[model samples]
Target: MISQAAYGAEPNKDRRIPVTVLTGFLGAGKTTLLNAVLSETSSGKIAVIVNEFGEAGLDHDLIESVEDEIILMQSGCLCCSIRGDLAGTIADLIERRDDGFLRFERIIIETTGLADPAPILQTLLIDPELARTTRMDGLVTVVDAANGSKTLDAQFEAVSQVAMADLILLSKTDLISAKVTDALSMRLNGLNPTARIERPVAGQFDPKQLWGLSGLRKGVRQEDAIAWTTSAPEPKIDPLANLSGLSKPKPVSFAPTPHDTRISSASIVLDTPIKDSAFDYWLDTLIALKGPDILRVKGIVFLEGIDVPFVFHGVQHIFDPPVPLKNWIGDDRRSRIVVIARDLTRPELQRSLDMLRAHQPKTGTKEEVLLGHD
Candidate 1:
């Protein structure tokens, strides 16, 4: 863990304090970047919110921000309780600042590797109270240049993070050759084209570049919507192309890799509004049976009685209540739901969703709809 004395940033007082959410896969150098920024000598006072202080056991270091840390996160990923906790923490921080207990000009939230950043971003964006004081600056994701391709192939979490990033940081360039680094960058660009790619030389880069990421400062507009919806370009070179020399030709399939063969994602769009009761029954039944296998579930639903779209985010068995959006941002009014899970298939999820929309009672022999069964 980076000591508090080592972390510093130049404060910006001219605008509303921007809250940046830092995310990446496990061992993507997030801690290293946090340490680098926090340990460095600067004029800004930045407050950092982490899941737990014991994960890396840095609480004993006697750092400067110990009292300032928000310990609201659970041992695992951020989920149901996190929305309220995050809102409360930010509100508390603002209160303390108002009382002159905190002098920080900016804030950064470092999420766990397995954590999904969508809910956190939504909380900052939709929470009326938090939005008044702090706006979402941007989402910065770190990718390990040397082994990032394999990580992305194996972990849906990594792919989602890359897909959602405003800025992709290619870390540890010094450990890999230019060819490998360039190939990884190409792969990343294929995943997200609008994100600015930054390469850190010797694990160092200017902190200023991380702030002021476009589109996230306010709410999701047409431009912000386009950033996520843009089509990814095809890779110039296959990441596994160089490995053909020592191994036999690999079998071709629709699967990404054997590592993530059990993990899959499915997107569903419903043209008609769903009754709240039917939606709840479907979600409750699905989560009750397959919660552990479900990694992350997020969607915007056009409920029958609601004029505005409702957003919901879930991790494992824990889920936050649906949050109503102010209004639909784009012309597309179809309700969209994206589910990522382990040992799951798109057909099974789509079937489950269909059953839910129909309000059909679950049959005991429905094991075929779940992963690892049929």
Candidate 2:
């Protein structure tokens, strides 16, 4: 039997701080968003960490230089640049907060433009001390609407950033035409069907909207779980008919680039409850074989003989503890899993899921009890 501890299951003893990882390719307007969040008085107390404090443009009067390491902001927030190790920097911050030196409710780490966010996420999951003190709130990626398509075609890092984001903030929309924005949105939707896409209004966004994005959080609702696991419906484009009654304009479609082709997102649905053994085998085999290629995996599973369903989330090979929805009450018992991977096809994922379905309880199989039916 697989123990719950193996899945990283444990009850929270105290309120762990929430951390948001912000990432984007070069010139994606991440700095602008950070400035907006820091300058706004209503954003509450936040701790912002970056690779270089100078490059972040901390010129706003709301920010007051405290010391070489940390800068105190007038909005009751703090901004600092990472000195050495990320884990160490976070540990120091936590220590200060516990020692009554700093006051902040959330932490945001802005990665360099060329950085991949998966490794950072893996660190948060595997590190025992960090996991106990912090919870992953969400991954927010900023994409420049005008140059996003070309960036995706040229850089695999940008593609990975978009693929792994829970909330994508589309920047530079005002500079691009409406048609261009729609095409880029379509491309992003194809890359990450489960992510929530939003265009920040005039380089401004509500800091509150970025929190509590993880669907596997404690006391998660059924609707939130379904929203996180299910893919967005394919958009419908109506044919445009001219007044001359001639042929209608065909729908606009963005062709997948080479980099875009490298990443694929697909969801699997099983009508019946999956046996625990089946789920364990399928997940273990899949992770063992394609762990490096998997960018993200999330599911709401209904296991046989278990009354309540559980929500599981994973990044690459490391998985967060499965959260059981004991309060779930409804007729829906179907299991849904969404996988986003690089160099993995939908057929390959389906084949693995087939193994789980094959293990479902068969009629009269238990009655036979290791004896020949004949």
Candidate 3:
């Protein structure tokens, strides 16, 4: 959990609102899940910004019809459309909220079905005012269990959505068999090993599950931190000779799909603390050369001469400022970094780490030899 101090001061001192980006492909039950969230009275006042108001099936009784663009829900929530500019829309909401015209605890942005989440995530990090006033809580993606495999096989966008998700809600599970749903879950795990996958009951889930999902915040548990930055090891393949050949079994061929080969998810662990210069140089070079292909990079870094470790997060080229875990305890000092990239292989990423290791500051001076005097 991120304490109020994580935002730099007390809650009253820092009014940075947390924003959650909700996204999914067409017919993935995004609307159903969103409606469930809004209908739940236990969920605090939430301001929802949708790409299109006409398409969002918000309850009529809840909407007070404030204006052409804004609809005030009886539950004390606000609903608005993008009106062409996301940043401008959010800025207006902030102004109104400050002026006592609106009330909401957090903001949720729902993107179009075909939307790519990378650009939306970049906007939050790149916009100065947005970055100052709002912090990204996390990204929640809805996947249709019945059609997930077909969608992934047909649309790379759907695959990308699965890859960049922090929380994946498997919707429409009731429409499919358990065997099929389990297969989809395994595929999702392969696409993104870090994301938490849940099969929401009847397309409904607790709103609280969406909050504080970054896992890079202060006061977070060490296990949670490790889970967020560590990738599961690839399954080992055994030799065919080990199998029983009493009946002369048929030969098996192994092949990976194009999508699987395109996106690579891997992690590297370093035993020693990294020098400041070396870490910066390696990150800068990697982002400069492969920013577009890079989807997400997150890590817990322990720098030389620094007592507390810094948690860093990045989406492509844009990155949030590293926050120090002042209260972090334990003697485990290994640095761990996870990267999800497109068209980048594990060996390539390893080579980049090798560069960082090669550039590390040399330690200990050797004593001068007295061979000449002897």
Residue 53's C-alpha lDDT in candidate 2?
Answer: 79
- Each model's lDDT: 0.61, 0.80, 0.76
For residues 1-374, could you state the per-residue lDDT of candidate 1 as single tens digits?
Answer: 01122123323332567888899988898877765555444526676676665443332232432232442221111111123488887787778778976567777888889877777876775677876677666789999887898888878788778756778988987897655776677656544554678887754577777776743222344444433323334333434434544554333223344444555555555666666767777787778878776755666666666565555656566554444445356555556665666666666777777754464223311212222212
Q: Report the Cα lDDT for residue 84, model 2.
A: 83
The sequence of per-residue lDDT tens digits that candidate 3 reaches over residues 190-273 is: 788878888889634787898878865656667777777775432222233334534543333323468766778767666667
Ranking by lDDT: 2, 3, 1
TM-score of each: 0.55, 0.89, 0.85
- For every model shown, the clashing-pair count is 7, 0, 0
Best by lDDT: 2
* Stronger candidate by TM-score (1 vs 3): 3
Tell me the RMSD of model 2 versus the true structure.
Answer: 6.6
